[model samples]
Target: MLYVMILAIIVLVYVLTRLYFLKREIKRTTRQLNELNKNATAKKIDISYFDRDFEKLAKEINNQIDLTKKAKAEKRSTENELKQAISYISHDIRTPMTTILGYIQFLESDEITPEMRKEYISIVKNGARRLKILLEDFFELSIIEQADYPMKIEMIKLNQLILEVLLGFYEEFNKRNLEPTIKIPDNDIVLRADHSAVKRVIENLVVNAIRYSSGTVTIQLEEFNTSVQLTISNSVDQLSEQDLNHMFDRFYKADQTRTGKGTGLGLPIAKSLMGKMNGRLTAEQMENQLFMKCEWGN
Candidate 1:
C-alpha cells in the first residue's frame, strides 16, 4: 500500500514539473510579444524548448514579422517618391510659366522694335509648348505606373522602326548641328514588343542625344543570341557620374543650377515604358560621352 502511494506521488510530481515548464515558456513568448508592441521593430521571437510546435510557431511568427518590415519599407519609399514628385513638378512648371509671363510683359512694352517683339513672341510660344509637353509627360508616366497603359505586343523589326523614328527628328538634328553616325545590322533583328512603346523609347533617346550633344552622335544597334541592344552615344557638356546614375530619375538635371529648358521627363518616361514592355534601359558616361542603351529580349 505504501509503495502504491509513493508511485502516485512520483507521477504527480512529474506532471507538475512539466506543467510548470510549459507555463513558463508561454509566459516568455507573451512577454516577447508585449515587448515587440512597445518597440516599433517587430523582431523575431527566439525560444529554446523541447517541442516542434513551439519552433514552428516561432518560424511562422518570424515570417509575419518580416512581411511587416517589408510593408513598412515600401510605404516609406512610396511616401518619399510622392514628395519628390510634387517638388519637381512645382519647380518645372513655375520656371516655364514665369518665362512666359515675363515674355508677355516684354511684348506689352512699346519701346521694343519689331525684331525684338518677334523674338519675344517666339520665346513665349516655346515656353507654352514646353509647359504643354511637361503636363503630357507627367500624365503619361502616371498612366504607365498605374498599369492603365494599353499595349499591343507584336513582332517588331528594330532597324526599320529606328530609321523611321530618326527621320522624323531630321529637323531637330539639323537645328542642333549634330551629324549622327548610325550603325545597324544589315540583317533584321526582330523582337516581340509593343510597337508604340519601342518607338517612344527610341524617340526619347534620340531627342536626348540631339539636345545635349554638341558635335557627333553615334547610334548603334546590336543583336545577341537572345537579346537586342540599341545604344545611343554622344558628347555631352559637364555630365558627371552622379548624373548618369540618376539620368532616368524624373526631373533630374545634370546641372541643377542651369535650370534647363527641357521638361526632364523623356528619360524617365522611356524607362517606365521599357519596364512595362519587359525591356531594360541603362546608361553610362565615358569621359564626356553619354551612352544610353535599351535591351530587348528576343
Candidate 2:
C-alpha cells in the first residue's frame, strides 16, 4: 500500500505539471494573437511548450497570415499601377486634344494667309492622327495582355517576313535618306509562331529604330544551333541607363519632355506579343548606340 501511494502521488504530479504547461502555452498564444491584432505586426504565434494539436493549429494560422499579407501587398502594387496609368492617360490625351483644339481656333482667324491657313489645317490633321494612334495603341495593348488572346500559330520564315516588313517602310527611309544596313544569313530560319504577331513585333522594332536613329540604323538576323536572334540597333546621342531600363515599360518616353513623336507603346506592345509567343525581347545601350534584340528558340 505504501508503494502504491507513492506511485499515485508521482502520477498526479506529472499530470499537474503537464496541465500547467498546456495552460501557459495557451496564454502565450493568446497574448501573441492580441498583440498581432493590435499592432498589425507580421509575426507568427509562439507556443512555449509543444502539443501536437496546438502546433498544427499554429502552423495553419501562420500560413494563413502569410497568405493574407501577400494578398495585401499585391493589392497595393496593383492600385499603384492603376493610378499611374490614369495619370499617364490624362496627360497624353490632354496634349493632343489641346493641340487639336488650339489649331482649330487658329483656323478661325480670317487675317491668316492661304498658306498659313493650309499649314494650320495640316497641323490640326496631324494632331488628330496622333491622337488616333495613341488611342489605338492603348486599346491594342489591353487586348494583347489578356490571357485568352487568340493567335494563329504557323511556321514563319523569319528572313522573308523581316524583309517584307522592312520593305514596307522603304519609301519613308528613302525620303529621310536614312536607309539602314541589312544583314541576314543565306539559310532561312523557320520558327513556329504566330505570323501576324511576329510581323507586328518586327514592325514595331523597325519603326522604333527609325524614329530614334541619328543618321544610321542596322538590322541583323542570325541563327544558332538552338535559337534564332534578330537585332535592330541605331545611333542615339542622349540615351540614358534609366531609358534602357524602362524602355519596355508602358508610357515610358525616354525624355518625357521631348514631345515630337512616338506613342511610347510600341516597344511595350512588342514585348507583350513576344512574351505570348514564348520569345524574349530585350534592349541594350552601348556607348552611343541602342540595340533592341528579339530571340526565339528554333
Candidate 3:
C-alpha cells in the first residue's frame, strides 16, 4: 500500500509541472501576437484578411478617388474654354465698333442736315460709350481672374472717399430727375483698404442705384468698433429672390427684357474688386427697395 501511494504522488507532481510549462508557452505566444499587431498599426498596413466585404470597400474607395480627379480636370478645362471665348468675342466686337465710330466721325466732318447729323452723332456717342464699357469690363474680368495681382492696401477716410465719388455723379442724378440723400458722420471714419478698388466699388453701387431707382436714392455711412458699413438704398419695384441671389454674379442682368446698353459686368467687377481689397459687398431687399452694402474692416 505504501509503494502504491508514492507512485500516485509522483504522477500528480508530473501533471502539475506539465501544466506550468503549458501556461508559460501560452503567455509568450500572446505577447508576440500583441507586438505584431502594434507593428502593423504603426506601419499603417491594411492587415485585414481578404474577404468579399473588404473587396467591396476597396472598390468604392478607388471609385471615389477617380471621380474627384475627373471633376477637377473638367473644371479646369471649362475655365480655360471660358477664357478663350471671352478673348475671341472681345476682339471680334472691337473691329466693327471702331469702324462705326470712324464712319460717324467722317459724317460729322461732311456737310449734312442738322437733324440727320444730330441723329448720327447720338448713335455714334452711344455706340462708342457701349464699346468702351465692354472693353473696361473685359479688362477688369481678366485682372480679377488672374492668380497673381499686387494688392496694395492703405488706410483711407471712408466718408471722404464716398463723398468724392458721389460728387462726380451729381450731374447724372440731376439728369435722371432723382434726389440723393447722403448721411455721413462729421468725423472721418478710417478703414484699411485699397483706395482705387474701394472707389470703384462705391461708384458701381451708385451707378446701379441710379439706373434702377425711380425717384430717390439714399447713401448712409456707419462706423462700428471693428468695421465700417456703407449702404446705398434705392427705391425700386420689388425684386425676386432669384435676382437678389445672383445680383453680383458675372453678366447677370436683373431685367431680361429691359435692356438699353450695358455690359452686365458692373456689379460683378465691383464684387471682385471688393474681394481683392479684403472687403465684402452684399445686397438686401426690402419693401419696394434694394439696399447694397459695402463693408470694410477698420
* Deviation (Å) of 170 in candidate 3: 0.8
In candidate 3, what are the lDDT values of residues 209-294, reduced to their tens digit?
Answer: 99888777999999999888999999988688999997876556687532344666788888888888778889998888899998
Q: What is the C-alpha RMSD of each candidate to the true structure, in Å?
A: 3.0, 3.1, 12.1
- TM-score attained by model 1: 0.86
Candidate 3: give the clashing pairs: none
lDDT of 1: 0.87
Per-model TM-score on C-alpha atoms? 0.86, 0.85, 0.68
Q: TM-score for model 2?
A: 0.85
Model 1: ten consecutive residues of lowest lDDT: 253-262
What does candidate 1's lDDT look like per residue over 101-200, in tens digits?
9999999999999999999999999888988988999998888877667889999899999999999998988888878899998898888999999999
The C-alpha lDDT values of all candidates are 0.87, 0.89, 0.77
Model 2 residue runs over 4 Å out of place are 1-27, 30-34, 37-39, 44-70
For candidate 2, lDDT tens digit of each residue in 1-298? 9999999999999999999999888888888888887876658887769889989999988888788779989999889877876788778888888998998888899988999999999988888898899899999999999999998889989999999999999987886689799998888889989999999999999998888888899999999998899999999979888889889877778877536577888999999999999999999988898999999988
> Candidate 1 clashing pairs?
none
